[model samples]
Target: MTADGPADLSGLKIDRDAPPPETGRLRRVLLWGAVTVLALGGAVLAYRAANPASVPVAVARAEPLGGVPGAGATEILTANGYVVARQRASVSTEVAGRLNQLFVEEGSRVRKGQVLGVLQNADQKSALASAHAALASAEAREAEAAANARETSLARGRAQQLHAKGLVSQAELDQAVASDDVARARVKSAEAEVRSTAARVESAQVDYDKTFIRAPFAGAVLRKEAEVGEIVSPIPSSGGLTRGAIVTMANLATLEVEADVNEGYVSRVHEGMRAEITLDAYPDERFPGHVRQIVPTADRQKATVLVKVAFDRLDARVLPEMGIKTSFLADSPATGSAAGTTAVAAAVAIPKRAVREADGRAVVYVVEGGRAVMRGVSPRPLAGDRVAVSAGLAPGELVIVEAPSTLGDKSRVRVK
Candidate 1:
């Protein structure tokens, strides 16, 4: 039976497994899935690293329109100019002399008639003293002449009385009268000498006072042109070490802007015209001003007229010769008769270039913490290249001007 069973089993075929284990199949699928996912993640990281979302743009600060006088006024013309003080002067001595003492320095506030410098007055002082002595001597000589004239007249009267009593001859009376006349003439000559000396004393005093340099007006000293021991003169010197002025000063209260208007636009400007002044040093600050004067002359070469504009209220920030830009406005009686008196509608204004159209809406990219935040704004037209944002912006916010096409909400930006 065992031999027959073995022979039959050898003829029969055995059942074998045709598919791999289910666990092995599942493991292979998962390994490929992980590799694909890792590859995709790496690709994403590489793309992001190579291309950043940051954009470069120019930026401008949103400013309040109310603070800018004549912002709403119709600007007829614009011009560039310089700030100048109407009462500016270079203080110098009336007479040339070496400076002995300097009482003021640059930036020193001086009052009218205050001594700014004292010239070497040793010679002047000696001359003044000599003058005073001469005056005193003249006065004493005048008294002496009066006393001598009186005494001679009395002696002549006594001689006349004796001659009338027949105690003397007619010749003696004549002689007495001649003696009195001579004495009187001598007294007159002495009086003339006294008057001449007195005039000389006065002239000397005036010359002495000329040595002290005094401020002509109340102002701040802008420059110290002469130092102690330096020669200062009324006239400029080209020969030696002499300065024409001891100090240059200006009245800060009289600060004004002198702008040159193109001859074509000169008709738009007139005396008392309201203007908005912006200083180059303080671009954001606008000052209210009025046309003070139109210089009668014009520059033929530049074809420009010089217009002087005075500030409504002088500020300490304003200085002489500072560069400024001015906007001359058309008459707006409803706004106000004078500049800085009008109450304008409060709005935040930015450069027109800062605004962009996004999806049929006006948008501005505001920069905050180096990131651009998109804001929907309702814009209105403003003077010049400015847009007044009536609905959406606040004053002092930075808006991106010349925004790049790729700029988006919360995009990183580098302000140029």
Candidate 2:
């Protein structure tokens, strides 16, 4: 280390041999500036190679379109829906009692008037027997009263004879007459008893009949709530009704699809509108149906109207509680199938990737005369592969399938 700058310069001996030493910040700055400019130019060249302003694209001829927007185009819509059985009912007991016997199980086919189950009826039996006995006694009494009435007439006749012949005292004759009157009253009393007992018999028979529960309609039993010997009661519980359905039965033939239609369009829907139904379980197949009913009531909260659809032809695969999608073609169909005209066959299609939104309109880049051009078009679904063009582009006009970022009107393009 040198103590002073003057001592170090003497030992270094001037390498004046090393040409005149460079000096001045301005000259050094200028030298660096040139090197930086060369480096920037090289970088710009590399970037041009990485991302070119002009992109290569493909071109294809547009198809001839009919006067119609596009031939064979389909307009698809999506809506949430649910499926339900048309004929549904809860089988409940009319009276409370212990279940005595259950013949049918869940999913059992039952006929109208078929015995589904029986309720414990020891009390009913007693009531019926008592009623029958009372009825019989009343009948016997009525018959006896009629005979007494006849006998009383004879007694009156005898009494009259006694009075006329003076064979008996006036007081004795009066007593005979009073006895005949009492017999007549007894006959009237027996007749009243018979009438009352007949009513009791009818009531008792009804109670007895109720003990054996029978099917109200011909259908299948979907569920069973009571088992043999189970003490079931229709009493109120936490749910307000302790007795649930004894069994669920449905007339499968009367089954229908119930769906909610938007209230805005419900007014247009009417009875007899043809419908296309597709089950979630069967995606490929579509079943035919007709609008059987449109519920007059609307669900105000949901703003939807309930529509009931009946099958035109029943399929064995169709069952209750399957999810379904219903398509309504029109409010009123003209004739034949209501699916509509086939527009998907004659339309020219393009991938959505090839389209772009510009100036608040749907547009696509068309390559024509060695340049990129924009064409406004209305797109509709076609064969699931591409959307058909409705307007603006003509047949045999080449369009850029893939749009380039730097592309513009009359922009040079290399077709790939």
Candidate 3:
């Protein structure tokens, strides 16, 4: 039987295709794990794409008002305005002519009576010369007439003497008197002509003076309206190229702010009210000012009244037509410097919009290292649209004023 079953291979069949059961299970598990990881990663990416991680927000700094004592009284009202010069003029010539010379340029400072420009003077000069020549001729004629009158008076005297002596007829004496009278009348007529010619000369001189455009007041030139060779007119001309003004000038010393107060809040502002003016161009600097006047009329369309605010001390930095913000105060800004010092010491203020409610507590999103740091603050109502931060805010920290509703603590924000 052992011989018959020679080299039976059934018990030892070669099976190279089959793997170990444990190894097969391990490979299936690894494949499924990789697929599950990829699906989860795709879901995470979609969710992130749907909801951005960083939000854009408008932010404002938590400003410390150096201790504004009675800030409430100090800033009773706020209004937007623009700086304007009380003495502003667009200087033009009295006569229309081609501009021959431009003495001043834009931004040039000029003194009163300074020659700013000159019109073409050839015609004017000619007219003036003609008038002078006429005046001279009239003077010469007047001199000649006076000489003739004197000669006639002497001749009449001689004739009377002769008549008295019975050496001349009565008719001869009468003719001599008539001749004298006629000569005197001719002299008078010549005198009148001289006066008329003198008046013409004066008129011509005035016309000649009109050719030079002079500054009415000392000021800084804001704009150059006409260049040399451009025509300038005293009155507006039909052609657009004819400029009515050679230059627009403003007295920098007379720079003031003209604010528009809402009619509803106009009652809060009054003449001589102290104010703090802030220029948009110079945000860090605050200029002291006072309400100079409240316009009698109101703008029907804007529902606002114009208020003039004059700076207490003029600064060269101040300019006409600059955007400005004014805060009307209760006391006079000129009383003393101490009042300003006190105002600077009183409070740290931030826009009311910066304070947001979080978990039933008043909190502010302070920006630090490009991330929003939620700080719980004890906010007290301050003047205008600001709140004083009694706690949890420093003077220079930036706070988010307008943020998305979903903004949370530690949220990354892009400040606008």
Candidate 4:
């Protein structure tokens, strides 16, 4: 209601298009902040790409310590080895021949003296038959010779009686006695012939039996080297077609781990020392064992000694020639408890750097699915470099060593 014509509103409504100074300043500040944030984010990404966090794998694992299979064992030494049978044999024919039949296959369980395969033995059978006939003929001749001797003795007696009664001359009685002596000598020769024939028969029978391949001991068949119609020989043949063995069988009951230990470290191992065996096929399973024997000889080229370790108990999954790893345990003397039982504390010794103290408890970072997972463990002071964990951890689990401060539970990590 200004009567000075709606135009006298001077100085109040002059700049309708100009932006406020404070608003512009505020926008500039926000723009710069956003740019700074983007720049910092890009820098962080580049840094991460160049330098990724890495963690070393922990070597500690729960395993059998001694005597019996249990957890929390300390591994003193580790070696790669193979499962071997103490009583392994390659069954073959004594004489070279074409295999006629096979009685066993791979993984077949057999007993000692059980026939595993048979070779073609028609010729051997025929020879044995001939020997039997010859033996029979010789026996018949021996009987005939004995009958002649009896007749000759009777005649000699008759002649002697006649001579004593002066019914015959001395020359006649002498001739009869000489004839009896000849017959007795013939009988002895026939008996010798019969024995010789019987021996020949026995030899023939042996030859026939040699065609059958028998297991040397109770074991499991690992491989079949020969098939029907294939030639098998006890000795290696010059040709490739002939098989040197019929079947390769091993006494599974005698399964043991054969590890090649470094000559320098062999001194630390001895017979009856407790050991833990792990097969590649069954990595999580631990088999308690003991040192069976150390080979007297060392490999000159490898500079290693062969050590055989026997299982505390056998498992059906343990087979000959399987890849395995062995851990030799330090000997811990058994102590008698108040209950009159042996009390032994089996503890897993891990590198001290791998363990972290959190919330006044021992914690270890284990790798699972490419992530670091924390596990609480009961720890005790072991040696200078290690801590003994009495609980919480399993054999063959990958643990992160010297975990980074940034590592948290379920954090993504790369193990080196």
Global lDDT of model 4: 0.82
**What tens digits encode model 4's per-residue C-alpha lDDT throughout 1-416?**
56755665566777879887699889999999999999999999999876665554433454323332233244678888999888888888899999999999898999999999899999999999999999999999999999999999999999999999999999999999999999999999999999999999999999999998899899899998888999888887787878999899988888889999999899999998888787898776566689989999999999999999998768777777899989898755567778886746554656667788789988998788877788999765432355556667655676677545777887767655
lDDT of each: 0.83, 0.72, 0.84, 0.82
Q: By TM-score, how accurate is candidate 1?
A: 0.62
Better of 1 and 2 by lDDT: 1
* Root mean square deviation (Cα) for candidate 2: 26.2
TM-scores, one per candidate: 0.62, 0.57, 0.63, 0.64
* Candidate 4 TM-score, C-alpha based: 0.64
Q: Show where candidate 3 strays beyond 4 Å.
A: 1-73, 331-416
On a 0 to 100 scale, what is the lDDT of residue 274 in model 3? 74
Q: Give the better candidate number (2 or 4) by TM-score.
A: 4
lDDT for each residue of candidate 2 in 1-416, tens digit (9 for 90 to 100): 56654354467565655645565677899999999999999999999766456668876667653322223222222223555566678776777777778888877888889988889899989999999999999999889988988897898889899889988888888887898899899999998999999999999999898888788889888777666655556553565335555777888777678888888878666788666577888776555567789889999999998888877657767778888887654422123446764323333545656778888988888876666887787886432245567566656777787755767666767888
* Candidate 3 lDDT by residue in tens digits, 247-350: 99998988899999999999888787778788898775566668899999999999999999988767777778999999887742433375464322234678
Of candidate 1, the 10-residue stretch with the lowest lDDT total is 64-73
Which regions in candidate 4 have their CA more than 4 angstroms from the true location? 1-73, 331-416
Number of the predicted model whose lDDT against the real structure is largest: 3
Rank the models by lDDT, top first.
3, 1, 4, 2
